[model samples]
Target: MASINQLTFIKPKQFEWHEVPAPTLQNDGEAIVKPLAVTRCDLDLYMASGMYPMQGPFAFGHEIAGEVVEVGDGVKGFAPGDRVIVPFQINCGACDNCRRGFTNACTSVEPFAAYGFAPTGERKWGGGLSDLVNVPFADAMLVKIPDAVSITGAAAISDNAGDGYRTVAEPLKQRPGADILIVAGLAQSVGLFSVQAARALGAGRIVYRDYDAGRLAKAKALGAEVIETQYSPDLRATEEFPIVVEAAGLPDALTFAIRSTQPCGICSGVSAGMSNQAKVPLRSMYMKGITYTIGRVHARTEIDHLLDCAHCGTINPDDVITRSVPFSQAADAMMDPDIKIVFERD
Candidate 1:
């Protein structure tokens, strides 16, 4: 066991890293991956801050670009030394939900069963941030990282990048030259990924709103007309968008997207049910004829499409990754409040 299974948690802001037993393959279809680079999602940061409803000291992360260390007899597609991505959710490929392309809601596993999220009785898997993490249904769940894309670039593909790809690319694929408005708050990387994905799909006039000046600058660099706005319901009063995405994962941000969308426009959200009372403007949404979508990402189902863009350099995830650090200093990096943080192994 390399470094054992390390546990890192936020008491709510402070984090601790220590040794636990490394995970092992429990099933014939399972594989053990030693994560080479583990990335943090904004959700992790939010949970760390103790704002959400879940209790912690659970596995600390869910995103990674890692190397396969061991594989069970039933696993045929991957072997030791193969670099792969472990998506946050676990889906059995043969299930009805997975066959229909909804792995996030797969009937074979407990609802929202992923490596992250505080371990409830229904789900309990070690996070990928540790040395050796188990991946069940490995042949179906794991997606290989393209050689052209760096480990840092591929880090978020399991969830953030793939979700952002679906969020922007699928909607705008037919609407050539359509304009986009992105309201980004807590979902720092996905927000930026949407910009890149939208640009790759031939979007026009992407206008991004975020409070972080650094993030706004990164968005600007990615060809979006960026604005730094404080967190409020009134992010804007008049700007109507054809395609609007609220990757920030805030109810207020969703409301802001709803409030600003044009009639019959699509307003997609990156999060669902983070707040007890989100207070939607149902009347306004109905009047405007909005189409909205929010929830878990079907990462395994969508990885191929995104990888095509990545292979040709159509989307640049590396540009948005603001900081890279040694895995040992991950606690410091997590506390630094970077927009996107990728941790490398020794």
Candidate 2:
């Protein structure tokens, strides 16, 4: 077995790399991938800080783009040496949910499968933060990276960009040209992607609320009107947007999203923390006729279109990548507040 090194969270605020056996092709539909580039999901930070409860010693990454090194006998439309982006959610393409285009809630894998999160025991595949990873249901889970798209640029599409697009674009289709309110953070990629996706979806106006000046500035640079606020007392006082996205991954942001949206508007969230106890103004939502949906992204649903937008220069996803670090420095890079880090294997 080839030895693969992976970063694991030993305890709160601590991380270390450990050597383990590289994954082997366990099924006829699986493929072994050596990730070319990887980026931290915003959720990983929560798991690391003990804000989210997770079993210890699990592999710790989700977003990845890589080269396929091995393909199972039943794998089709892919081969060794093919460059591809792995969707963070695992799904069996033939299920009812998959057939209906709800791959994020696939029945084959537990509620959340991809990386970092504990497996549903249906598939042995872990997160993508290693030298090698086995991707089951390869035909449904992998998207071939376009030759025109750089590996680094394609990396975020596996999760962050895809989540952002799905969260913003999918719902906005029901109500186009509505004002969009985004609750996001500087360290979080989902917020940044929300801003870009909202703009791409042709929202009448994009208003963002965040405490980080850098995040606000970045949002502004991407054509969003940003407001810096503490989100205290009532976040609704800051702005009233017709459509809202809670990408902040905090309870407060969720509250803000429900309160700030206009009556009959849509609110979509990708905040992982919502799984825990979170207070939502149910009475307000009921009275206002507000619609809410939150969870893991159905990446395949939006990645190809998002990639097309990125390739055409209409939306530059690379603008959100604040820094790139060698894979060996993954832990330190995550701790760095200076920039959002993208880790690449050297």
Candidate 3:
């Protein structure tokens, strides 16, 4: 068996490069990939900081754009050397939910089967920050990176960027030129990417709120009207928007977003870490007839449209990356305060 080095999260605020057996094709439909550009998701910070409450000693990092190294005989549309974005979720395309484009709820694998996280599945699929990884459903889960998107820019297209698209793209299509409000702080990249997606998809005006000066500046640079304010449950939008996004993973932000939606409007909550005891503004939501959605992103379904926008220059997710480090420095870089970071390999 061949061995390779993988970044492992041994404990909170600690990481190590551990030697692990290289992945091999277990079936004809599988493929092996060598990640070239791997990006960190906002959840990584929570997980590594011990806020997410997940056990460690598992491979870390997942957002990936990689070169295919080997493919099984059954693999067709891809070959060795092909560059692809690996979705964080493990999905068999033919499953009922996957066929309906709900790839996140794929039934063929265990619930929430995914790479990087230790609890996602029984067998580790390995993390993107590794010498190699196994793609059990390559044809279903891997998307070829378009020529217009560089490898670095394509990294988060597999997850964060796609999650942002899910927030506003379809809603904007329903109500073109409608103004949008994004309440952001916790999920930093996803919030900024939401601004980028809204701009690319024809949203008329975007108002982004965050306490961080750097993030507020980035949101402003992305063509959003910026509002800098501390997180307060009392914070409320003076005016309702047809589309509202709550990326801050707090009950207060979520409630504020619900109250900020226009009548019959949609509020997309991208945060998943809010307390279970958080209260929903049931009376307000009911009276306003608003639609509130919160869950994991269906990345495989959203990446295609996101890549099209990227190809057309309507959005460049590369701007979301605040720091870039060599693959060798991934373990140390994880402890930094950068809003977004990518590890690159030659």
Model 2 lDDT per residue over 45-150, tens place: 6667766667676777878899999999999989999999987778788899998888888887677666666666655565666888888888988889877787
TM-score of 1: 0.94
State candidate 2's TM-score: 0.93
**Residue 24 CA error for candidate 2 (Å)?**
1.4
**After superposition, which runs of candidate 1 have C-alpha atoms over 4 Å from their true positions?**
1-3, 231-236
Clashing pairs in 3: none
In model 2, the clashing pairs are: 115-127
Q: How many backbone clashes are present in model 2?
A: 1
TM-score of each: 0.94, 0.93, 0.98
lDDT tens per residue, model 1, 1-346: 5458465674777667778766777889999998888878777767777766567677777888899999999999999999898878888888988998888887887777888677645647778678888888898888888889888877777778887888877668656788999999778888899999989988998999998888899999999999877757666556898799888777677788888788898888887736766777889989889888776678878787888999899986788888888877776666568888888886
Worst 10 residues of 1 by lDDT: 1-10
State residue 99's C-alpha deviation in candidate 1, in Å.
1.0
Best by TM-score: 3
Worst 10 residues of 3 by lDDT: 271-280
